[model samples]
Target: MLYSQYLYQDDKPFKTTIRNYNASDFNQLIDIQKECFPPPFPSDLWWTKDQLANHVHIFPDGAICAEVEGELAGSITTLIADNHGEDHTWEEVTDNGSIGTHDPNGNVLYVVDISVRHKYRKTGMGKLLMQSLYHLVVHLQLEAVLGGSRMPGYEKVKNQMSPQKYFEGIITGEHNDPVVSFLMKAGRSPIKLLPNYLDDPESDDFGVLMEWKNPFLEKRKHFF
Candidate 1:
């Protein structure tokens, strides 16, 4: 079989197109999430049809999806927050929490999640999704974009080791994950690490706080 045939199980060509997400797209969006995340978020957390339709309510105006020939390929969520100063004290209240610190006018873009299908890994779809989010952030005149990177886990090697050891490996790799490469490429800098910050008792997971300033902003300096 040809490469395209093997990948899509059909002879159709691959074409990626991005558009604002709608309520009708929920099931397809959930399917893409399942294909992308190893331990995917529960179905309850997946944005419902009503949620996607109200993009401004759940996220920023440009929150979008990339569909390849009518099939959901990836999705991204963006939002804004107020400047809360130097201390991330509010993080104590939430695991995937986001806050925008030090905005006199209270303007900052927070990218909540970005995911792409497994078969499309390393194909620039991730970057494309990010670029789309960035454009939305810029269009909204946000001060900056903030997000976190999770450490990769044993799903890539689950069959070879005990679950405990697999989690250990994930924690180890989290401290040294190559995510830094992508962040640096996107003009972002690592600000801090929240150790053992998750709500789940069994989760040894931590989070890395990162930020990317808007290069177009004038008189930019330290926020806090």
Candidate 2:
């Protein structure tokens, strides 16, 4: 139900632990979101404390967090979506920015949100969290992991290129948007380029619909 990783730097060991959400993590989640995301994060995207409390209560393992030396460094939240049965945008699944639904039997692991504290951005914490999610996909026997990836560098070239062009550039390595680049390197493929997916200038108000198929899913289903 929980996991941990140890890394060494300067001959010292730092432990990063991944675990399910709890009541006390509410404030830290808020702080991490404020630091990692641009100003005025849509209220619906970041829920109120009471709402998050309810969410964790309903789907305890749906949310996971990473801590380094007992301090919160990153977090990831997921929901089950039946992407194989129908097509739905991030907004529709998230209830127009509010994390309003989670279908446990759905075949897709919908990564509703993921973030790392600003201070730990460049470190490997984010990757560890992602690896944990990948394992989670295997553990749950899901079809794939799906989400809308941000384009942090979009503002710099929004006027110079269209959303599709920008997305292609990133896919082709011509553009170096941090989030999309990271996802691509992690083996996720873009399902489509979404325009105005979120109202963020830093991302040029765009998002890339991304998916990472689970290679073991079919085998697991066959055995089960």
Query: Which prediction has the highest lDDT against the true structure?
Result: 2
List runs of model 2 lying over 4 Å from the truth: 8-12, 40-44, 84-88, 96-98, 219-224
Model 1, 1-224: lDDT tens digits are 00111122244445677777776677887677666543442344445555555453444354678777667778887556664324342243222333122222557665556778776656666776777666766766777777655444333554676444543443455423444445545566666654553322222344456677777777554664
Give the runs in model 1 whose Cα sits over 4 Å from its true position.
1-14, 40-60, 84-105, 153-181, 196-203
> Model 1 misses residue 56 by how many Å?
5.4
**Model 1 residue 130 CA deviation in Å:** 0.6
Model 2: worst 10 consecutive residues (lDDT sum): 215-224
- Pairs in steric clash, model 1: 83-100, 83-101, 83-102, 84-101
